[model samples]
Target: MRRESPHAGPLRALFRQFSAFAGVGLVAAVAHYGALIGLVEGAGASPVPATLAGYVLGGVVSYALNRRYAFDSDRPHREATWRFATVAGVGFVLTGLFMGLFNGRLGLPYLPAQVLTTGVVLLWSFSANRFWTFRP
Candidate 1:
């Protein structure tokens, strides 16, 4: 057994960062799903496009919250914003690809597919944002 201290500095920091990030993600997800459901059920938009739109809305929210809340980054906006967008662009593509696979091909319902997609994207987004977008 290789047990280690519970309060190890780096490990604890990572856990705290991820916890804050997940909290912000929840708020961002509301914006995302709100747009998705509204467009799909109310406006008759297809799930894919609706979700894409929602992803954009959520990305904006995520960036705003995550910079300070999750990462406590002191990076200037001029630099950080572009890095954030770059990471988000990759996430957007992943979102579309996974959504298509899950819903369009696998025949899962749109909401379920979105939930899966969110989990996948969350890992990518957190890593990229932590290492690149908001690095201190």
Candidate 2:
């Protein structure tokens, strides 16, 4: 049998990484929406409050997963944590803005607002994660 060099599969490598990211993102998205719905529907919280709670919970999960799995980061330091938190904070603001736009201003349904926020949040997160949190 002919052995193929591991480095010979660029397409496979990209797909593998994309798959890993997507998997992790799916988990985080569930966490985000779950908390949001739980707070708003179950706990009778307002949309903004629910969204805030969701962001906090989802942010924690996202940081943990992105650090350990997505980026395979093992760095331990206040600096790294703060940097990561800063990036997440930026994401939070953007998420909140869109959520508010959809839910409050546009009067869209909760789920629809959440879906819209998800796309924006995902793009923002990928940028921050790639450029800041896990930058080389």
Candidate 3:
């Protein structure tokens, strides 16, 4: 076997993987926060309820994109949905925490909180989906 460079192989691979996952996550977050803002401000839904609805929609979009594009998980549909839900539940907690900080404490408003929390939870969500939810 050829000797690998000290900081080339794994590091480069990790960077590429991170880039791709981050890209997909960005799209999913857009779907989530878009729905959230629309539901809350436009529809006059409560902040918490709007966030929950957004989470559900985001979870669905996230599973579809991440499975086919991000991790390429090919497991059966039912099993995959179960795993996806389990992973998403963790992200939901993180989302809620940051949202509470903004909406409850900081009073920064809904859209800003949603954007910030999406960034905070992106890495965690990607890792959980890759290692746990989509793993063989």
Question: What are the runs in model 3 whose C-alpha is more than 4 Å off?
Answer: 1-4
lDDT of each: 0.96, 0.79, 0.79
lDDT of 3 by residue, 1-136 (tens): 9987898988997677678777777787777778888998899987766886788787887788777777777788888888888778888888888888888789988777777877778878878777888876
Order by lDDT, highest first: 1, 3, 2
Among all windows of 10 consecutive residues in model 2, the one with the lowest summed lDDT is 71-80
Which residue window of length 10 is worst by lDDT in model 3?
A: 13-22
Q: Model 1 Cα displacement at 83 (Å)?
A: 0.4
* TM-score between candidate 2 and the true structure: 0.83
In the order shown, what is each candidate's alpha-carbon RMSD? 2.3, 3.4, 2.9
Model 3 residue pairs with clashes: none
Worst 10 residues of 1 by lDDT: 3-12
Q: Please give, for residues 1-136, the per-residue lDDT of candidate 2 as tens digits.
A: 9998877697676566556766788888788789888888898988877887788788888777777777676566555688878887887888889888999999999889988887887877776776677765
Quote the lDDT for 101 in model 2: 95
TM-score of 1: 0.95
